[model samples]
Target chain A: MTEMLRVENLRVEIKEETILDGLNFSLEEGVHVLLGPNGTGKSTLLGTIMGLHKYKVSGKVYFYGEDITDLTPDQRFKKGIFLAYQLPPAVRGVRLKDILKKILNIDPKKDLPVEIYNYLKSLDLDETFLEREINYGFSGGERKKSEILQLLLAKPKLALLDEPDSGVDIDSLKLIGEALRKIAKESNLLIVTHNLKILDYVVPDSVIVLLDGKFVYKDGLEIIHQIEERGYDYVRRLVYAQNLS
Target chain B: MLKTYLKEIRERALKAKDKPAILGPDIDLEPYMRTIEETPIDDLEKLPDEIKENILYSGITPSENDKAGTYFQINHSVVYEKLQEIYKGKLEIMSIQEALEKYEWLENYYSRLIPPDTDKYTAWAEIKPTGGYFIRVFKGQKVEHPVQSCLYIKEGNISQNVHNIIIVEEGAEVFVTTGCLTHLKDQPGIHIGISEFYVKKGGKLYFTMIHNWSEEFHVRPRTAVLVEEGGVFINNYVTLKPVKSIQSYPTVYVRKGAIARLYSIIYGRKDSYIDLGGRLIFEEEDAKGEIVSRIIANDSSKIYSRSEIIGKAKGTKGFLDCRGILLSKSSQIVAVPILDAQHPESELSHEAAIGPINEEEIEYLTTRGFDKDEAMSTITRGFLSLEIPGLPKVAKEQINYAVAQLEKAGL
Candidate 1:
């Protein structure tokens, strides 16, 4: 099997404060979850991998066996890497339909494929929502569903979703999980969320623990149960012991 | 009737060089006046091929069997003028010169909307006004397609002063989409356009003007709309290209139960200075007015946007909104929005905001699949997009397409 993404010795600093400290992460494919407590660098890790230039990153990021450490966000997009922002900025005049067609590389005048409408209906969003400005005055659940809708249309090789399960009701969260499950069938999914509720609807193939910007452990689906039943304290102790060793 | 006003305005034009706060800076027109006098007037037979090219560049080429109506004026002469049989049979459309000669009653409406001595430019236009159209839609009739007018200037060191008058009779509807363009480079020219629109009782008139000028063109456009009881006037104005300097303040007067909406999108490119604004006044009870101005200052350009809404009587509503976006560090945008309600029961509101394009929004677009330039264009297109209700489909699309091309070419 080919490695989809690899991060080697990744260290990130923002405003002279260390965020991600010497983190090493590897994922082959399929749906994976980065479950960690708040204040950890889960979102920061995703942003760095997506080539946000604000953070001072000293490490190498490889995607599909090629070093993509220096690529811009636009370049990464062209190379089939997409990030669903947790709090996407509101584009005052750019409509959701316009950007959706733009991401699909299709003419806005042409009819969007039927599958998109189907996905929208399944997500409980009316087609009229496409004509609205991107994320402007949208509810939290609407924002998440909008992100998921873009992910479905983008069909990227890898999707990094930051906290899709947060700030959403159970129904919207379930819809997002279902949408993620549908997308994971064709592409890779790396979800960053503090909560473990979404896993009930669509379980992850693997789970990684990020604590204090460090990758503490990586295991199969079994680890999700352990982390949920007991707090992250046990994982913190394990990481401390591992570092001491 | 003409002598009394003409004598005073010409003298005012002669003495006018500066000193109007709303008109911004002034330009010396003596040199251009001489060039314009020496040059022969261009008619259809004497027109050069470049005029056709400019017409095509403006995205609408005249056809032999064209529908609705089409009018073109170059410099001080009418080049191509046509009123489709359908429109001509019902409405009266003719050149300003022809209309003046045919109708003696037109003298009343010539400058009623904008007085001759209102500004230096208006005085100049009154003294040496040239090519413009006169349109009157008969009472109780609705015209589907707009009366298309193209005003183009080519030669340098000249002036194109035009006066247009449009009157929609009671219970009638009419629309006009005019394009002012100059393709020449380094040819210093001054253009002053005076437009007056009169909407009678229960009538509606929609006017759209798109200006595309070169870097050396100085433009001064004065416009006014008078709406009677229950009448409506919608004006959409945009400038998508570079210009030396431009100053325009359009006013709309709304009467009892009438409404006026003025929307404008102004773009200033390198070294360009633009002062664009709209003013609305409610003179009678229960009148309504709204104004929206979107200013995009890019590449060291400076833009001044002013929106004012005033209510004179009770039970009136007025709104004014001015928004600006600066695309470059050197560019600047100043927004002045004022709302005044003299009556105790009248309501007036205003909002003004000026900000630069958020870099995070650009990156957000890039992360979605657009390249840097594409992202910039998308953000700009969205920033300037204001949905003007009842705009002509073809005209709206043509203007939008031209704007998109301008954005792709980087302002």
Candidate 2:
């Protein structure tokens, strides 16, 4: 299978402060879980890979084997790389459905598919939210699901989701994970999240533990069980020893 | 373009010997043959720059400093000369002198509608031979379409004394639109115009005007409307660039139970200065009047608006609303709303709001792939289009076209 995304020795600094230090990673055509604690540069890595200007990256990034380290966010977006931000923005005077339809380039004369509305309903969004500005007054979970709705329409080759299960309830979380597992099979998934509760639904093939801007371990689902009980102390010791060596 | 047009008009005037619609002193040419035979033509090349600037500043009407009789130079004057050369016999237009000489009956009613002391510009314009347009819609005669009067100001430091008297007789309705324009390549110019509208009892009159002048020129406009009982009057005005200083005050006086509405919008940019407003006075009971004015200023421009709604009737109602937007840090706008209700039963309401565009909204739009400039343009159009529901179709289209041009200019 062809590699969807590849990062080689990625080093990023924000205002002279190092965020991602010499990170190297790749994703094939399946589910890949990226587990990390707070302040571990998970979200920063996602932003840098997506070409968001909030950080200054100093390494090469390749998408579908094409160099994209200097591409703008819009240019990268047009090349089929979607990033689901942890916090969605509020756009006033622009209706939610209208924005989605325009961005997706759907036909205006025809009705949108019922399956999309069903997904929105499953995520606890209502008709009023669709007519209002995009995420103008939405709650945390609703905003997340709106992002997912955009993801389903855009259908990017690489989906980098930043904490998809952070603010969702149990039922909605299950629905979101299920939706991802079903639709995300056509592309490579790079899930950067702290919570492991969604793993039972997504059922990752491999799990990587990122600490201090570098992956410390690569294992299977058993790593999630180990981290849940042992509480990242061993990983912290490994990160310290690696820094010293 | 101008030279070609002027040549055609000169040829037409020279060929037509039959006295065609003369607008100045009715000289038989046979009686004053010797005086016309000796008038010098070399002095007509162009007025001196100092004299042009002086006339521009002093409100360009001819004066008699020397008691040399002056010979009543009809063809040399701007109003009579231009009217004689172009559009002489096509339309029913006349200079004040010509009207007094030939149509002498009009002198009693010409400046009577807007007398000399009615305002400062009128008082000063009364010196020269003012041009007058007497449009009388007969009783119960409703013109199927509106009549248009196009006036152009070309001479430097020349005061265009136009006295427009529109009489809508009883049970008659007429729509009149006047356009005042100046060519782009013309020298520095100044115009002082006076338009007086008289709506007789049980008649309707709609008057609209659009003014476009070069920013180097100074303009002072004074117009008035007197609506009798059961009469309706509507006025709309717009001012554009190339005009340096503009001071306009359009007033409406409506009788008992009459209806009046005034809508005005002014956009200022690039060192422009304006002090414009409208006034409405109610003399009878149950009268209704409303005025809404919006102004936008940017780039070291200044605009001050002072409007008033005076109600003397017992149960009359009036509303005054003014809003403004300041785009640049150097721009300034101030509005003063005044309401004087003499009777306790009368009502008046006033409101105003001024601020910049919100930062959060701009950021949101920028994040969605639009740049800061595009976002600002969209917000400006949306803000101005909020008043489109009440305007007529042609006016609404004009506002939209103006906004498009502003965006194209990257404002």
Candidate 3:
């Protein structure tokens, strides 16, 4: 099996406050779920891995065994790494079609290709939605759908999605989950989610528990059942016992 | 009657030429008074290659295809003026001097909306006037294509004073695209333009102006519009090139059942100082007015965007929107929007915002495969792309062409 992503002793600080400290993790080429509590720096970890400039990062991030910690976000994107933001910013005057044209290198005078139109339909979005300002007035479900649509268009080697199931309705979750499953068939997916509801639509190969900026436990789908029944405090105590031993 | 009106206005202008304007830096008129003669050309192909290229940059095509009429002025001469044969009697295009000599009734609209003594620039335009276009749309006729005009300044260190008049008769509609530019890139020059537009009852007029002047040009354009009852007027203005200084505030009066909208997209670059604004007055009941302005200030440029909407009659409505972006540390942008409602039944509102480009937006674009510079450029172009309401197709195409040209010039 080939390693898709590896983070070695990663420490992230935003505005001089440490958010993720001494985090170490590695993932293979498959679908993985990241489970954490609120404010556990799940989004921050994803952003740091994508090379967002806001975070003060110290440590190493490897994509397919290549050092990528110092690369810019655009440079990282060119190396086949992508992140679906937890909350996408609203760019007031930039239309979705305009950005799509830039991403696909399509001429401004030509229409968007048919595959994107098919993706729009599968996401239950109108064709006219491409003309709207990007994320300007989108609903919660619509924003998630837009992220998933972009993921399908990009087809990167590794995808980092933050809480793709949080604000989505059940129907949109099914659509987005199906899209992620399709993406995972060709690319590795590391998704941050709070609940097991999304698990019903897309099965994961492994589930990792992150507590206090470090991975506490890693297991198959059975770990999610334990966490749901006994909660993260149980896992915390179990990890504490192991550390003491 | 035309001769008498011209004489009286010229006298007033002479007396007020020394008077200072209410805003912007004052300039001495003595240096620019020296005129250089340019021979008139009946065909556009006779223009120099550099001159033609500059005109094209301002959104005017030398071929004149798909246009209702074409007017070209170089320095103080009207080089070419032609109207498409298909629009023979429905549309009229000629030099303002010829129109004044040919029709006596033109005196009514010559300086009616904007007084010659309103400001020093207007005064200078009347005192040492150059040739400008006189366009008219016949009653009950709607011209499909826009009439294109190019005002080019070939000689440096001279003032090009021009006065233009546009009249749309009752139930008629027309679109006019004007491009103002200069051939010299670094020589000192000044252009004073006084434009008056009148829209009769049930008439519609769409006016688009693109300015592509050089770095050392000082431009002062005074424009006013009078819309009769049930008329509509839409004005679009774009100035993306470098200029030494520019100050303009076009005012419009909307009567009963009339509507007026003014849109301005201004990009200030390279030490340019631009003070652009517009005012709309609702004069009677059921009148509507709107003002929208988008400004981008870069490279130590300074811009002041001002908009005012006054509602004086019952059932009147007005709104103003002003947004700007400062791309450089030294660049400055000031937005001032004012709304006054005199009548109890009138409604007026305004919105103004000025700040640097959003970092989050830049970061978002970078994650979508754009480098830093490309991300910034994309955001800048998006900032200037405004969805103007009620604009004709031809006018929109012209504005798009102007923006594309600016982009090609590394904007």
In order, what are the TM-scores of chain A for the candidates?
A: 0.94, 0.89, 0.96
Give the worst 10-residue stretch by lDDT in candidate 1 chain A.
Answer: A194-203
Q: Give the CAPRI class of candidate 1.
A: medium
Error of 3 at B299 (Å): 1.1
Q: Please rank every candidate by TM-score, starting with the best.
A: 3, 1, 2
lDDT of 2 by residue, B257-280 (tens): 776767666667777777787788
Model 2 regions lying over 4 Å from their true place = A1-245, B1-115, B139-144, B184-186, B360-370, B385-390, B407-410
Q: All candidates' lDDT scores?
A: 0.82, 0.63, 0.88
State each candidate's clash count. 0, 4, 0
Residue B236's lDDT in candidate 1: 80
Clashing pairs in 3: none
For model 2, the local distance difference test gives 0.63
Q: Mind giving the per-residue lDDT tens digits that candidate 1 earns over A1-245?
A: 67899999999998999999999878887788887888888888999989976789998999999999999998998899989999999998899988888888898688777888898998999999988899999999999999999999999999999999889998898899888888888888899887777777666878888998876588888877777788888788877888889
Candidate with better lDDT, 1 vs 3: 3
